[model samples]
Target: MRIGLYPGTFDPVTHGHLDIIGRATALVDRLVIGVAINRDKGPLFTLEERVEMIESEVAAIADRTGCEIVAHPFENLLIDCANDVGAKLIVRGLRAVADFEYEFQMVGMNRQLDNTIETVFLMAEAEHQAIASKLVKEIARLGGDVSKFVTPAVREALLARVGRA
Candidate 1:
């Protein structure tokens, strides 16, 4: 089967992420959502919470696209995580030029590590392009409405995390 790995911290899965996941499902038989355990970032949500949010959010997409979606938490290198999941494709969502510059370097480094795996970039739709987890969290923490950026469940989670709920 054609398996693709999409790696991200997913502190709180946003609509931008869901848009990418929905689009990615059409390209691969199985899409593994790699929830990165990057302690350096100091994510607001736990790895388990992130995985749970992704799982809850992607269920409808999986059903509609007929693609198997699974969440795999990884603390190791992204390439190693892809290898562990048998993913020949690494899917990335691009929001802007800044994202491209970073992702370009990542692809180059990943190619050096494993030439067999290819990275594919999917541009976020215009409406969702500016929706980032960091910004979303900040907005929620400041008592702003985040319903536009995240699902109701994720919005609630963010609010609860920030003690605004």
Candidate 2:
């Protein structure tokens, strides 16, 4: 089976992230959405909350696309998680040139860790090019409507995180 690993903090999965997941799902037999546990960056939502949000969003898409979404929390290296999940490919979303640069470095590092694991980059939908978790949080925190940038679950999660709703 062609299993792919899509790793990210996914603090609150944005529409852009979901878009990439949907597209990547078509190319792989199963996609594991690895939620990286980063001690350096303080997250807005708890790990459980983040997982719930991602699960709900992915579940909705899976209902329509027949894609399987598995959520795993990885504290070790991404390559290790990929190996554990038997993922030969690592899927990444490219939002802009800056994203390409950052993802490129990570891809190179992953290749160094395991030459057998290849990284695949998918561009975000044009409308969601500027949509990111941080930006979504910022907008929602300030009472701006983010209905177009995230799913209903994410929007509610963001509002709850910011103590707005």
Candidate 3:
């Protein structure tokens, strides 16, 4: 069925993320949003919260594109997660050269682990190139407006998380 896996922490799903998720629908019949449970990163949102956010954000896109979107939380290796979801393609969003450099290395390592699964990179739109979840959280923590980077619902969630709401 041409399932694809797009893995991310998604502490708070940003507009940039939604852009990638929406675009990814065109390449696969089902796109599984893998919400990584990286305790080392100390994510702002819990795995359940992240999954809920992804599911809420992608609902419209799924309806519009006629693609089935589901959120799967994983604490294991990304390649293993892909296999669990029956994904032959791993979709990644690239923001800049710096992102590409890291992703390139990941692709090499992932390929060595499973040559059958291919990784596809989608460059973020120019407007979203500068939007990152880390930066967004920082901005919200410092009492800055994040309406430009996230949806209103997400902005509210961020604000509440940072005690701004």
Candidate 4:
């Protein structure tokens, strides 16, 4: 079985993320959405909350897709996490040239860490190409409506986090 690891902070899974996840599933037998517990990123939601929200958001279509997507939290090196879950491919989404540049560096580092795992890049859907988690958080923090960028569950979580809900 071809397993792919889609690793991200997923502080709050957005529509853009779901777009990537949806497309990545078509290329692998199983796609593991690894939520990284990175403190440097200053996530808005706790790991458990992120995992729960992602599970809720991905559950409906996870089984319908040719592949199954499992959401889980991991606090170790991404390569290690991928190995733990038996993933041979790492899924990444590219929204723009800037994203490509950033992901390019990480891809090199990941390859250096583990030559066994291959990295696959998927371009984000045109509709979601502009939606980013940082932008979503900033808008939510400034009391702007983030309903269109994120799922209803994620929007609720963001609103509650910023005390707007």
Quote each prediction's TM-score.
Answer: 0.99, 0.96, 0.99, 0.95
lDDT minimum window of 10 residues, candidate 3: 45-54
Q: Residue 126 lDDT in model 4?
A: 95
Model 1, position 107, has a per-residue lDDT of 98
lDDT tens string, model 1, 31-80? 99999999999999998899999999999999999999999999999999
Q: lDDT of each model, Cα atoms only?
A: 0.96, 0.89, 0.95, 0.91
lDDT at residue 156 of model 2 (Cα atoms):
81
- In model 3, what is the error at residue 56, expressed in angstroms? 0.7
The parts of candidate 2 lying over 4 Å away from their true place are none
Least accurate stretch of 10 residues (summed lDDT) in model 4? 60-69
For 40-149, candidate 4 gives per-residue lDDT tens digits of 89888888998998889988778778578888789999999999999999999999999999999988999999999999999999999999899999999999999999
Off by over 4 Å in 1: none
TM-score of 4: 0.95
Ranking by lDDT: 1, 3, 4, 2
Candidate number that wins on lDDT, 1 or 2? 1
Residue 60 accuracy (lDDT) in model 1:
94
Between prediction 2 and prediction 3, the one with superior lDDT is: 3
Encode model 3's per-residue lDDT on 1-165: one tens digit a residue.
999999999988998999999999999999999999999999998888888888888999999999999999999999999999999999999999999999999999999999999999998899999999999999999999999999998999899989999
Alpha carbon lDDT of residue 83, candidate 1?
95
Clashes of each: 0, 0, 0, 0
